[model samples]
Target: MQKPKYKRVVLKLSGEALAGDQGYGISHEIINSIAKQVVEVVKLGVEVAIVVGGGNIWRGVAGSARGMDRATADYMGMLATVINALALQDALEKLGIETRVMSAIEMKEIAEPYIRRRAIRHLEKGRVVIFAAGTGNPYFSTDTAAALRSAEIEAEVILMAKKVDGVYDSDPLKNPNAKKFTDLEYIEVLNKGLGVMDSTATSLCMDNKIPIIVFDLTKNGNILRAVMGEEIGTYVGR
Candidate 1:
């Protein structure tokens, strides 16, 4: 058997991905499919920490009043991430994978508080850890949260799963001439201003020397393929 390239990874899943075809809320079929893939990676001895976005539930900033405070809106977004965290926790456990939900915001009844050392311990013990609440601060994205957790946990890479196959020079949906990049250096992504992730998220990975593999999560087995470091998607690294 071939050795997996990475021993540990952080997966950043957008809430919309959890919605599946409905485009809203938790879809059991989608969650089950994702859980199964995660189980396969864990079986390979790859520790996984996941950071989930809240776009499907709500983006408070998108609904904030013109006079509303940005911090307040961001707080709402954090709660949305918590909702996603709980849903993922349930799904993973249903798949018989020991899972832990750690929140940046304190929610003692529902999950554990975000403690870096404790999270690392869980991964070492073969438990899946889900990180939620977006850095516990406003004005940050879940992408940044995933980067931060990956650095703290000493993860080998960041698996940035999306709805698309890979990053393109132009929106492939809008332009047929769009070209896909199979690989990229951090500087290339920054220089080109590609939307592989937010600028803040991209910079964090670049500074930490953590590569990101962007691929379509909806495609079966892509998560395990990424963890094995196969040539499946555009890799942005230094």
Candidate 2:
């Protein structure tokens, strides 16, 4: 019954979040949970777009470290994102939410090629659009993809769904004394090397004046809370 603070938002989901506790591969339960949450927001009349990562299935950096060609490994990582996108589409459709999977790389059989106008049109029609394949280029991250998409779509904010509740001064799991920040400026995030996102992605958001909410996706109702403007996670912006 409550109104959402952001009518249009881009959700950046990490591959590890989809993997759930197993830390590898997709988890049906996790995917379903995310789908349900997204449905709830859609019902509230929010336009949603998602950019999913592929760290669970593959990591380009890791592969390159093991002697694989950087670009080849990155392409593999992009494929991994497509896999997660299809999985998410399946879950959302099963829940009666019309969803479209748009890929950066051409995969005509399975997904529509990424078109900026078509993506916006889907959102205007109340359909959720899931963006996969990491910008169709290597040496770029899904974070950057999210930033780029959010800017393109004119989204009000970015919901950065992560396993951790928020940005911390240190790794909270490793150091109990780590400080939790409720708010941060983009320059602070970058200058401190806080790692909320890659510098390029963070800079993109900063230049565009787009806000990002980094919250724990594993927490029940957190997605909804973030969209509704409830104080739940680290808010990063100008």
Candidate 3:
């Protein structure tokens, strides 16, 4: 029984991660697997909050078409996050872990509206809260949402779970010679224009001095490892 490095952490998961290998839509197996890991961390006395992206269902910029308005497209992207949140909620509850889905956009029928104090209360009560809808506005990615929520929740760290194992000097898939960085300072990420996260998200984390651990969530039990500070990924922070 190892002690967790972070007592309260925010996990930023892309919607595609929920799809498993299918690359789209929620996979029950993947969802259940993720829920299990979350439960493991919670059992360790870590207060966890999640911010999920909607790339699996839609990307606002990509959705923009010759006829589609940018705002409408972004709204649709927000809706996609809501869908991911609901699916994650189902999976978590099925595992007998208490969870709450809080969206920036008010949709009382589906989830509680985002309120900083209320969300904090949920975390204090040991319930995992999933934040969806991308800041409740357009021209923002869920990455920014994750950063914002991490600051609001006063989380110890942001677990940035991606498809890639770690941050690379170049696209690892395309360049065999690309170097992988095990640790990076906040400025290095911003100075190099690293694609680890959007500039807005990166800037926010740097400003708040919040550490981010980027790793592949597809790896089983990675979440628990990260909370325990097992050195499994690229850590970017002060």
Candidate 4:
């Protein structure tokens, strides 16, 4: 077996990635596929932490644009992330992988409240820790949560699993001639206004000097590949 380049990593999964082709809700097949891939990485002895988004169920910004209270909408969006986290936890557990769903918001009934030490301990013990509900605050994207958690846990990198294969100059789906970048510097990502991640998330990672690998989650075994340093996606760092 090949050794993994990163001993510890934060895997960021957008809710839309969990939605799969349905484009609006969770898909069992897709979740199962993701769970299986995660198992592969776990078997490689890599410590895995995940930050899940809620765009599939709700988007705080979208709701606020339609006149909803911004904070209220964002809180609702946070709740949606918890839902996704539970679903993923269930999937991972079914595959015999020990998983914990940690929420930023206090929801003791279903998940443990976010405790940095506890989360890191879980990773050290070979358990998968899933971070949900963003940073438990409004106006912060889950991408920011991923960056924050990665820094806290001292993760080697952030694996941003997206629908697209990697970062591009334009939406590859819409622009046939869009240019795909093999690698990028943090300044370029911000200066060019690339959609790799939100500015806040990008800046946080840059400040922490954490590298990010943006790759397609739809592909089987891609997670393992990324962790194994396969160079299959856009590498963003200093």
Residue by residue across 1-238, what tens digits does model 4's lDDT show?
6699999999999999999999988999999999999999999899999999999999999999999999999999999999999999999999999999999999899999999999999999999999999999999999999999999999999999999999999999999999999999999999999989999999999999999999999999999999999989899998
Q: What lDDT does model 1 reach?
A: 0.90
Better of 3 and 4 by lDDT: 4
Candidate 1 — which residues are off by over 4 angstroms? 65-67
For candidate 2, write residues 28-113 as lDDT tens digits. 99999999999999999999999999999999989999999999999999999999999999999999999999999999999999
Q: TM-score of every model?
A: 0.96, 0.99, 0.97, 0.99
lDDT of each: 0.90, 0.96, 0.92, 0.96
Model 4 earns a TM-score of 0.99
Spell out the clash pairs found in candidate 3. none
Q: Is candidate 1 or 2 superior in lDDT?
A: 2
lDDT of 3 by residue, 37-142 (tens): 9999998889999999888888788878656789999999999999999998898898888999999999999999999999999999999999989899998889
